[model samples]
Target: MSSTTGSPSPDPLDGPLAAADLDALVDEWGDWAQVADLLDVPRTKVGTLLREHRLAAAVPRPGAGQRVPLAFVQDGEVVKGLPGILTVLHDGGYDDRECIAWLFTDLGLPGRPIDALRENRGSEAKRRAQAMAL
Candidate 1:
């Protein structure tokens, strides 16, 4: 498509690519049950966490369910800083999908936000999230 002046229209995929790239960060994402199993929690608790925004489903599966990014889990626990980061992002007016995208995207830190968190840089991640609200 072209604009009224005949300039080529921007690619529809351009904007979506940013969000879409989160899919590439992991070979596969997990469903709620998978996440609950990883965390050693009951499946119902996983639902509560998702509803409370303590955990997020970054992308939806093709058929019916949502997929949680693997980056958020470490050694069977949610990464130390993730819940707080999620809360900050949520307060900053980001939804679960946006929060996941932000975490996976490079934000000029040592690496992606999830990486920083994994490296025990939760404070830095939290700071960045706080900055987003400002």
Candidate 2:
């Protein structure tokens, strides 16, 4: 495991550790249902993306020329439930519609963040409230 002569490559998700750090993070990834809402994708599509991306385990380093078994927490979340999946995607900045489309045949949701945000935060009642306040 030497550099250019077989040195070990740096792990992308590596850094300072405080004893079982990876294990701890994996333990509290939270529910996929919340993640779906955060990602703005339907619950159904989560499984598809999991299987498609092979995201169940630690994602591999590109062209690292090594088999690094992932340090993933086994929450028994794959195929059956979309749990523990969306957190990774959403945290990685994949928006709702993108997450949905990647898993399903496109729910045809809005692609713009402003529109999406407005849809979530805006409403006729809210508009009226603003008007009245003014």
Candidate 3:
């Protein structure tokens, strides 16, 4: 499904890397409606999740709707430890787009931070995210 119109503007810090970088880093993204379907919740609940820092979404590119990286959810729930990582990143001044970009970026780990979280190796990713906040 297409993203809704009138999405909010990106944060001022959502730069250095372009939206295209995010697009390349993530293999797939799910719009709010799709994520809602996956979680078996109403579309409004997805907004709640985002507000709670249990999830994040971003517009990957101009003309595209806001979307969440498909990797953030597994089965019918958010991947374990993802909310914690998102909190760490957000506390460090990263808006959703920056958080998504950082998670998908490889920083000499066995894989991207998101992969580390998915593999239950979140401690290292959390540490790195903590450092990034400095």
Q: Which is superior by TM-score, 1 or 3?
A: 3
Model 2 lDDT on a 0 to 1 scale = 0.32
Q: Candidate 2's residue-wise lDDT over 6-119, tens digit each?
A: 645332124211211222233223244544444456755545555554333221223422111121112332322222233444455543323322222211243221223224
lDDT minimum window of 10 residues, candidate 2 = 65-74
TM-scores for all candidates? 0.79, 0.25, 0.84
Candidate closer to the true structure by lDDT (higher is better), 1 or 3? 3
Clashes of each: 0, 6, 1
Residue 100, candidate 2: alpha-carbon lDDT = 29
- Candidate 2 off by > 4 Å: 1-22, 25-28, 57-134
